[model samples]
Target: MRPLDPDDPRSVETAGRAYRVLARIGSGGMGVVYLGRSAGGRAVAIKMVHPEFAADPEFRDRFAREAGLARTVGGGFTAAVIDADPEAEIPWLVTEYLPSVSVRDAVHSSGPLAADAVWDLAAGIAEALVSIHGEGVVHRDLNPANVLLTADGPRVIDFGIARAIEASSVSRPGARAGAAGFMSPEQAAGDAVGTAGDVFSFGSTLVFAATGREPFGEGPWHVRMRRVQSEAPDLDGVEGDLRALIESCMERDPERRPTAAELAERLTGRAGASAEGAGAAGEGGMASLPPAVTAEIARRRTAAENPPVPRPRLEPPAPLAPLPSSPQPWPAGPGRYAPHSTMDPAQARRPRTPLIAAAAFVALLITIGIPGGLWFTVRDTGGGVEAAPSAGPTPTASAAPASPSPTGIRGELTFTIEGSGRVSSLTYMFNGKTTKLTKVRLPWEKTLQIPSWPPRIPWKLSYTCPPGGSSDSVAVDGNVIIRGQGSSGTNMRSEGVL
Candidate 1:
């Protein structure tokens, strides 16, 4: 969470209802989150749209539409949206306050989780996507930061929150909307992102949880995106079933990735309307998490349940002049007090700025050396994204065009290495350049676009591995013209230089 601005409003009122903010929870480029209580005294997280965004007509419409769409999301894995006031001068929405540690922080403080824990985490989040997508909302940016760890299971928060930010022209027009390292290739290219993009992010989050590193080695945002666009994920230590599943989720070809439902089913070992089975298994998912993560969860819960008490702010009283031994009860005349003139009606008619008073009060608390005074701080999910589209100015975050063949290449040059015992070493010579990889995951693939004009160019390939067989093929117009089928432990060397 970013530092709080002491001058921010202490409470927000809308629709004849008011919620008092204790302190700023956090701030983002688009809004400020505050730990507050509703009129009924229920604690909630109030996400207030930044004043600049609230002032934009287009943005208000988008906020209303997006907030309303967000209200439809339900299920245990997601934080519930309690209330919202989009029409208010300063729009705000309320979400259930989650008193738990974030997955990213837990991972950073501890280490990569065990495979069983990763599976539980994946299944729970996948089921969350099932609920979110069912309402026609895409989380757009699904990364570790947005997932909270609790005793029951991981709860995915800030669902569909990014769509509001993405809609504002303020959100860097034409720039890729998601955070670095977790963006899908299409999303990174500023192309329309969809449910498949979320699936890609889910895979990236798994990689983070399993390997404690971005699938695409990180540097600058562009550098990470470039890796996402062309390179296979670095699943160095991650192996076996989870590796294959995560690999599938991050497939460069979005269509080839599994749907949220399929992922839930796969990870939870459920079948026949597995989405339901997935939700059942997700109930006690946190049981698999490492002890460090569990301890963090307990700490957050305890801290939230029992807030720190502030030291009393006391000041020395001013000394008064020696009091008269006997007070005089005289001077009851007109001259004793001067009379005042009537004030202007306009001045009297002016409305009081209660918010200013509230701000001043909050500022006093902070300035007077009260730590976190009544305010509770919580972190926002960044290096991540959430939320989907809705009414007004229609959000710009979208998935790649439905069809890949039209905008994509017609002739596809494909290569694969299946039946894995872990590729200790694998290399490829592509477009005249050669590269090799170590500890490679199985069922690896690389596809190149063959332009229609140059359909007959470079339809040739050859490769050799220690024992595991590697396969390469060239196809034009969806028909396999040349093929090299290599079984396990067999060297495959074939060429079709047509």
Candidate 2:
């Protein structure tokens, strides 16, 4: 059926008395959206099935079944289904009137949303999908056009084409109930799809929200459909956490994609993060976006209004009482509170006597400098070197033969040389102590330096490589010294500065 212009009066009277048609809001393949009022004076968007579909009993039944399932999946993230008439001459469904622009309008008019807003949008849509999917229904037509941006949050709409998990494939011939650039690859291929298909669509919606570009690229509807299956999204321009997320969603393999709940959690992690790129282009010189686009939206809205109803007024209340004075102040934000007991005393006023005593006790032992605090100081000693507690540190010098060097370092720094490498004999001395390493590798073991010596004493290691080896050196300061043959014809040298 041809789209009836909203300017035409006949379109307003097409639906039955179930709703009082006000003005046409929009139109699509399944239905025309009209701003209407219920018998109780509640505003709603009455979606009447197109005349072509209304004439077919099979299509009408499927539309009604899908809408009914959508209503059962109640959630704040979705527009609430108010009423519907499956037996009417023109089947129509009414949903709570959402006085906000669809995501398509927001992007086309105000440009793409900021990173924070984009994440929030993704979260809201994902939450709605979670609810829809929980009811065993798949919103097979998720797209930017079906998402509305309101003051409260983004809302998912138009479940006229949703499919129940157990629903049969008895849809009408021309009823391809999804946006061209937003459909998943599986959906485009006419294969049985599951929740992952919705995830793919959600990813495409994010691509639109992030860069004002469709994930599957753009062209004629058919050409765009072909791209969804045959091409990948060019994510070079999109930034922030969304880049990886969109990549995961748009991956050719559906099994690897995250579920709606998983996507919601991921997006929640990214909310309020800083945005980059052309997404922040708002109105006004200081606005985060361009003004021309917002103005166009406002103008379109004004033209669409029937008689321009007055904005609602909310009255301010009386002044609030003054807060009480107290020594204790309120905790700020989440997980913040004052200590209230010995387990967690206020750090400022807590006594440190115990800590001081503990420190003094340990320091006194160190100062005495004996293997034990005092040898035979106890009054009940048997006269000789009565065995002190086993915990006492035994003087190893007395226990073993006294050698010139008490302790020596011994550890192999095995370097795994990559790409035709070898290690030659290396020798270095530091503070009169000699060390040697042999048969290292190219690009790894050209020089060795022991850095534990006294100040200003430089030690060197001589190793050989196949003529051309690494000859680069960087000064690094540390207590334990090390130097080695380095990369690609450069002197491998590093100084440890303690």
Candidate 3:
């Protein structure tokens, strides 16, 4: 498992209960999602509202009441809502946690999905929309990032931004309310967006799945928003029946587009998740995907279920005579450096004090500034984009237990939040431990440190900053680095393996 990022919460309370924040999952314009577990060990995804949004009187009032309506949306393709507290100081909702990949990340990593896979994706999303719309909820933000691909099918998440039909129709003033390229023409014109807007956005998402490019073509979001307002989508790669269905959904006039139910039946020969023949073209619960993507998803599932816990840092072995000109590789698991077990037979039997000290020295060197060595490496992915989580073995629940004591050294760990030229107080936590800092200044972070090489028990963190344009990120043990910038506002997150 990865350590939580700075400003990440270690645990949160709701419904008169506390949920341990396992790790921060992803951050969006509306809120941040964290991998959490109930006291009884039930895994859930706890979504906490962004400070700025929670402070908005209009949005908060709507979120406090209508957000609960999301609970009414139940289907095979949507994550089940467990609990929610819209009335809380910072509204939060909880859902069953599922290890899955977003359509955006998948396409970016593996290229455009196969044609058959794209159709399956469509049927699943359409079915989910049927469930959502049936409950009178309009998913105003149906971008590719909100659709998660699971073993069963594609599941649409993050309805926290959606409002009930009986509620407000127009989006919050000055806010886009949806992804720029995917928003409908009415939405671009700042008009009331109904369920048809969701249909339009669905079409754009499909276009992206079929071709690894934006639906309205590439440029700044404003340029794309303008294209969405008046220009035809560059559907160069989409073909045949799929193309027809996409074009129908993307029609400029909302009245011209098929309702989600109609779309679902047309694609899957079924109108809802419970109906028979739910998947398209004889595929079962899942759409047929490329073997590579399928394998990666399975690997991710295994890893999530059997996450690795931090252990007491291992000490360097006592040094002995060094003479071997060449060394053979030793088998090990995932990490910055492999298990260093190979040693001269004579040296292996010697006392270990000196070796431990030497190893510590090397590990410290690597942690502070050196690129690579025997242990940890300080990874700062400063380019605003975070690298994908490194793939590794899926450790089991009954795997190695943590050492009883901590033998590692603590070093200064700094945290900084880039805001709209205003200092914002923040909160951060780890391993179910927490602290709140108020009126703190930004720039270089305060002191934090690490001593031992590979920590066994991983720490989790959370950050809550008042809205506006700001960036929040943390590099823990150099394993995970997350940054949220640009249109996503002050909230940022990225996932990486420990």
Assess each prediction's global lDDT (C-alpha) against the native: 0.63, 0.56, 0.63
lDDT of 3 at 198: 92
Off by over 4 Å in 1: 1-5, 270-285, 308-498
lDDT of 1 by residue, 1-498 (tens): 212233456688876878877654544434567777788977778888766667667778878887888899998788888889988888899897776677777788888877667777887789899899999998876888778876667778877767766676543244334556788888766688899999999999989998898788855344566687888889899888888888899999889999999887676653122223323533454645678777766765565555433223333233222222222333345677323344369945665454345345434333332222122111223211211121223222122222222132433455544444566666655445567777777556666655422212333344444355544333322222233446555555433321
The best-first sequence of candidates by lDDT reads 1, 3, 2
Task: Looking at model 1, report the run of 10 residues with the lowest lDDT sum.
Answer: 382-391
Pitting candidate 2 against candidate 3, the one with the higher TM-score is: 3
Off by over 4 Å in 3: 160-172, 270-283, 308-498
Query: Candidate 2: which stretches are off by over 4 Å?
Result: 1-17, 160-175, 272-498
Candidate 3: residue 339 Cα off by (Å): 60
Better of 1 and 3 by TM-score: 3
180-255 per-residue lDDT for model 2 (tens digits): 6788898766577788988898888888887888876754444565688898875767875678888888878889
At residue 207, give the lDDT of candidate 2. Answer: 86
Clashes of each: 8, 31, 29
lDDT of 3 by residue, 90-133 (tens): 67888888777888878888899877678778888888899999
Rate residue 365 of model 3 by lDDT. Answer: 41
